[model samples]
Target: MKKNILYLSIAVIIGLIGGYLIFGNSSDSSNQKITEVHDHSEDSTNEMWTCSMHPQIMQQEPGDCPICGMELIPAEASSEGLLANQIQMTENAMALANIETTIVGNLMEGNDDGVISLSGKIATNEENNAIQASYFDGRLEKLNVSFEGQVVKRGQLLATIYSPNLVAAQQELITATSLKQSQPALYKAVRNKLKLWKLSASQIDNIESTGEVRENFPLYATVSGTVAMVMAAEGDYLKQGQPILKVSNLNSVWAEFDAYENQISQFKKGQKIKVATSAYPKKEFDAVISFIDPVLNSSTRTVTVRSTLKNNENLFKPGMFVSGKIKGTAQSAEESLNIPASAVLWTGERSLVYVKPNPNRPVFEMREVTVGLRNGDNFTVVSGLENGEEIVTNGTFTVDAAAQLQGKKSMMNKSGEKTMTGHEGHLGMQGDSENKSDAISTMKMKLPMAFQTAFQAALKPYFKMGDAFVASDASQVSALAKTVLAKMKAIEVGGLGKMEKSHLSKSIAMLDAISSSSDLEKQRAQLVVLNENTVALAMNIKSPTETLYVQKCPMANGNKGAIWLSTEKEIKNPYYGDDMLTCGSVIDSLK
Candidate 1:
């Protein structure tokens, strides 16, 4: 009996030990799973997501871009190993944003003409200006020169002046002439005194011959010019050497151009310039740089560049708008480099440009550049850029936005400061759900009613395609996409605005992408972009022919969320047709 009790006890002890070993591990695993769940929830709350194309979009969770419909990316700071000023952009983001780059080439190599255009106006040549003054004190009796701008020739009759002193001098001359037989020296002196009064030899001889003193004396013009100013009025008393008329020789004029301080080096005296004017746009006049003012204009921050032009045909007029083109004197490739002005971002004193160091891939780094003279669309890079480098010329703002999101040196964040989750800085949609509700609020243009009508008229086939996608028929979707693309293209854009046209063209690109794909999911992905443009267009319509409901599926687009327009209020998500058929909600309505 003792041995039997001991065997039972040993068996029970082993069973208890085995049972404890099995159930304890299972319980610890359950506890570990709970812990992991709690940790994952914390991470989800902490991590932030943002769109690569539209950096302004910030959400607490991963989702599609509200503005551009691109996939959201982790809005984390770039690695410390990378350059602080460098930014990394996905290939898809670059393509979708239409970011284009230009290869920086030698300014002289690319531009053979090497001409800089300058805006200026025609002015009177001060060197050729002359003032007509009275030789003696007098009162104007008769004014012959009628008005300003009257053409006058040398030795032409200007006006008649009545001078008391001239009448006395004429009487003295007559008296001296009467005693000429007795006093020959006195007669010669009297004639010399009349000559000193600007009287011609014939007039003095006539006075002596007639023996009569004239009350009024005739004044003649000494220089040929146009009357610019009539200084004295008729019958007004005038002092000796007082101006009668201000005359300007209009045969020659000055082409005065405003040159910025940076452009001063490009100009020098005697440089050839081709001047053109709006008055005679078909003709160009040759001019030479006569002078460059040493002083700068404080108010305008410019210097005066004067060029002499001949106006024999009277084509050039004072105060007329003119443009001048000067050929670059130093055309060698070594002198300097040029870049598109659009590529540069100007800060108060600093200028910046995004440079792609690697030609094969889309890797960009911010480079602070020192820019000089601006020649129309291009700028001279005095420093901070090299030849054969590629720079972002178009979509510069988008690139800077990417840089700011990535915590790199950007136009808005030049110090490479890390953005605060990108939510506070950018006025972004807060969460995934709210972003869907605000997706259609991208931007609306004031389109013409005619364009809006035509745009709505073309949506019939597109609406059918949406229904086809919801039915999960890939073939039907592709076929209808072609029709939609054609219909959208066929719409007349007689009064469409530029922004509206850009949206239409971009939507066409999206449709082309959708029509060429045979896969349903791919078509749906492209449709997101098309819907973005379409919804914006619909929002501009005051009375759309067909009402549209902007429906969104939070579980679609890789669980990132995607939106589409539907005629029905019911949620029928085309993104995940039949799989999660009613997995969306109506976020907006357009009528």
Candidate 2:
């Protein structure tokens, strides 16, 4: 019994040792697997999703961006190696945003000269203009050149005049011819007097031979030209030296460009200029600077630069808009890093650009650059860039927009400042405090049916003026404003309440102010005030016939905000015209 117990104890000890070895290894493997699974779950939870457009939005799960309503994408992990101002983007995002880059090189490399751009209009050359006047007082019997723009040539019969004084003088000449044998000096004096009246020697001799006085004298054009103006008509009496018509020689025309105060230094008399006109877009004409007006137009803040161009083909007409470019000398050629104008973002005085640090990664950083001269489509880099560096030439705004959303350094915001959370940021409330002014007053009083009808009638011309402003037609705007003012004045305010009368009177005063000024910018400024009153009036009247949209442009009135009434919901910004034609939103819709 002692020997059997010893064998059983040895076998049990061996079995226990094998079981411990196998189970210990298995437990270690199971713990290792659990740790790996835990790490993966933590990483997944930490991953963030953001919108490509509105990068400010960050969420744990895939969703849509609240701002732009775009799908959320996996937010790129922040690389510790990147600068604080730098941002990394995915290749797919860059492609979607159409981000493009160009290698910095000699933008004016091949060109030996620099160029100065100019804008102006073709004008009648003053040197070639002529005024046709009558030499003596007479009743105009016939005017062959009846209208402006009539082409006349030298020695062409322009008109016939019946002058009693001329007839008496001709009769005196005939009587003197009969007395020539007795009084030679008197006859010579009479013949010379007729010669002074532009009568040919042959005509005097014929009158003497025929013994008759001509009933009327024919006038001829002294020079070849196009009639600019007709000052006199048939049967009209003109005094001596009175202008009959104004003519301009169309063989050549003047191209007068307005150079801003800052750009006057770039222009010099006798410089060669290459001019192109919208009327003849494919054709280019060459001209030399003839004169520069010493006096600057105070209102326009520009000096007139004049160039004479040959108009033998009559290609250039007066008032035709033209653009010119003056080539610069080799020394004047800009010798600096030049980038495309689209690459730079201008906000107040600050100019910003995006620089890519890594060529392999789609990463860009907002960099402030000092700019020098701007020529055509390029800007000379005075500082802040190096040669051969790649830059975002196109879709720069998109990159800056993304940077702004990320709360990184951007064009509008110099520092990485966090924006307001909800309505404030969405409504662009972070600018000048003056922009916070309410657009309209709360004085709402229903107007009489007569006043409403008249006010509605006045709106036609007002909207026409707005369209003129959108077209950038200053003269048209002024004319339309005048019409609106007239209609406003003609409005019958009888039987209207005191509040309605007050609103109508205020609108009339504003319309008068708008009409009194021909300056488009000044008119637009007044239109802002007019718009506020009109909004109040619309609120009071509530035209039953049409729907009006009260649109607000945040960039107008020096960014203090301006409102205008539009018939359509789509924005047609009149304040900035084509510069920011689609820059506003419908703040209120009324019927």
Candidate 3:
């Protein structure tokens, strides 16, 4: 009877403990669910609708714009919504987008001096030039403005012309003076005829008094300036209505500058420019924009900008090399955000950038921004982003790829529904599957020619060396390896894409192995091994991936050109083993 009673008490204790644990767990679960539900509901209620083209307008509900009938887009929940065209993304999506943020302070003021100096040469002001020509028929005589660079004043004697026509008119006047009594009307008509030849009244009176015709007549200057050119010198036969001299006002000069096509918009009329010259290093002359060439130079692909400078001390001379800083105001007067030019993805029509939303999570979204003035590598942000927002300045392509994967409007697409292929894989981090999707989209954008050349040049040497090794040619292999090193050393790889750098890095590493080989046999053997690896890499390599053919190629002596890529395997070459591929691979490869 006592054992049964102990068992009953233990069972009762166990039941009570089970009941207490189940109820306590249920209460905590209910509280957690309630908290989550409250946060989700708050987010749903605060959602806003905005126009993609007009981000400043915000509406509580989704609808068409009263002004423009364009569809409304969803606004980001964070401060990103305040930006121009911020596209919100999830944490995982952001990681795939490669959206990176950095902390930066506002530029309260900029230094008066420009960070970069542009050099150009001084030239004649075409607008202030004049050409002197004869108004009447003339012959060989004398020229006052004998040579170029001679100064002349207004009404000054330019040259003396001997004209048979003028001599005949003078004789008529003298004859008329003697025959005045016989024919007064005929004398008056003869006298008036001489006036039509641009003769002075004093010269006519001298002709009548002397009763003889002068062989040579003097010509006077129309305008005062420095003689730029003397077409006719002393004792040269001259014709009627022919240019005699070319003159220009030296008081004002033109400083012509060649601006890159990308920077043409930054220059305009009436803007201020501070000019200095290596010839006169101590002097800093001030000038203002007077004219900009309407057309771009087809050969140089640059725009010509002309600034007018007053040459008070005759310090500015034509053809003198000069350096200067241009102080230009933003095209838009309204205050707007500014970011590094490297942050923008220019797609010809629209400009895009990735803005970090959460600094703690390092999350960002793709945003379409309007740009105003492009001052060097920096641009003025007219719209699309707000102050205090984190932006991706470096590795913009990396972040743009991530955006494409997330189905957000990226540098390539806005809907994010399209799959972009055929992009040359550049260098950078690959986060996950989603990151790959985004990277593929971002790669669709075309890169600058300079960047493409740099990427390919890096891989040329490695591939060449690897091919040489595979062929079992010890001398050729050694030469090829050394050539790769020389090419890499000579190549200027300072600025390039991330994908390009990654491929080049791999190719360069392989070249480094070849370089360290002590003997020809050893180098050949290593190259053979490298060749197998390179072939394998080529099979798997994707388009839009950095390759050497676009930048660099092999050389006859195995040495690379001065401007080459660091890697060699990434070069996409069809003539891998073809003889004489190196000699003409690149144009002017020495430096």
Best by the lDDT measure: 1
Off by over 4 Å in 2: 1-50, 54-70, 76-84, 106-113, 117-121, 175-216, 258-263, 276-286, 296-303, 320-323, 330-334, 407-409, 419-591
User: Which candidate would rank higher by lDDT, 1 or 3?
Assistant: 1
C-alpha lDDT of candidate 2 relative to the true structure: 0.75
lDDT of 2 by residue, 1-591 (tens): 999999999999999999989998789889989988999888785579876644566788887555334578888776557777987787766765568898877555665346866667789988999998988879999999999889999989999999888889889988998899999999999988878777778878988899888778888898999999999999999897889999999899999886656667777888999999766769888889999999987544568999999989898888777778887432254456778766876653466889987789888998889976555556678789998888898667568767766678875566787443212232222222334332333444667788788788888888998999898886567557767876776777777654455446556655655554446886786676577657667766655478888788867865556778889998999998898899988766677
Ranking by TM-score: 2, 1, 3
Q: Please, what is the TM-score per model?
A: 0.56, 0.61, 0.44
Q: lDDT tens digits, residues 1-591, model 1? A: 999999999999999999989999899999999999999987875587777556766688887676546678766443444577777776766766678898888434556456787767788988999998888889998889979989999999999999999999999998987799999999898888878777788989899889888898999888999888899889899898899999999999999987777788888999999998757769898878999999986544569999999888888878776778898565533567888766876543467899988787667888999987777557888899888888998767668767776677765455777543222332233346443345334454678777777677668888888889889886677667766776776676667764466567657756755654556876786787577667767767788766788777767655555677778998887887788889988767877
Alpha-carbon shift of residue 298 in model 3 (angstroms): 15
Which pairs of residues collide in candidate 2? none
Q: For candidate 3, write residues 1-591 as lDDT tens digits.
A: 999999999999999999889998898899989999999898786677754333344688887543234456665566443333344444543443334455433532473322323446788877778988876777758887788899999889888999888888778778788889999998999888777665667878888987877888888787888899888877766676688999998888889876656667677888878898756768788877788899976544457788888887888788776666886543332355556655766553467877777676545567788876544435667678887888887556545554454355665565566333112232111234332211111232234555444434545655565565435544455446655654543444455443333334434444544443334544533343233223322323334344322222323112211112223433332223344334223211111
Report how far residue 370 has shifted in candidate 1, in Å.
Answer: 3.0
| Model 3 lDDT-worst window of ten | 556-565
**Top TM-score prediction, candidate number:** 2
TM-score of model 3 (CA atoms): 0.44
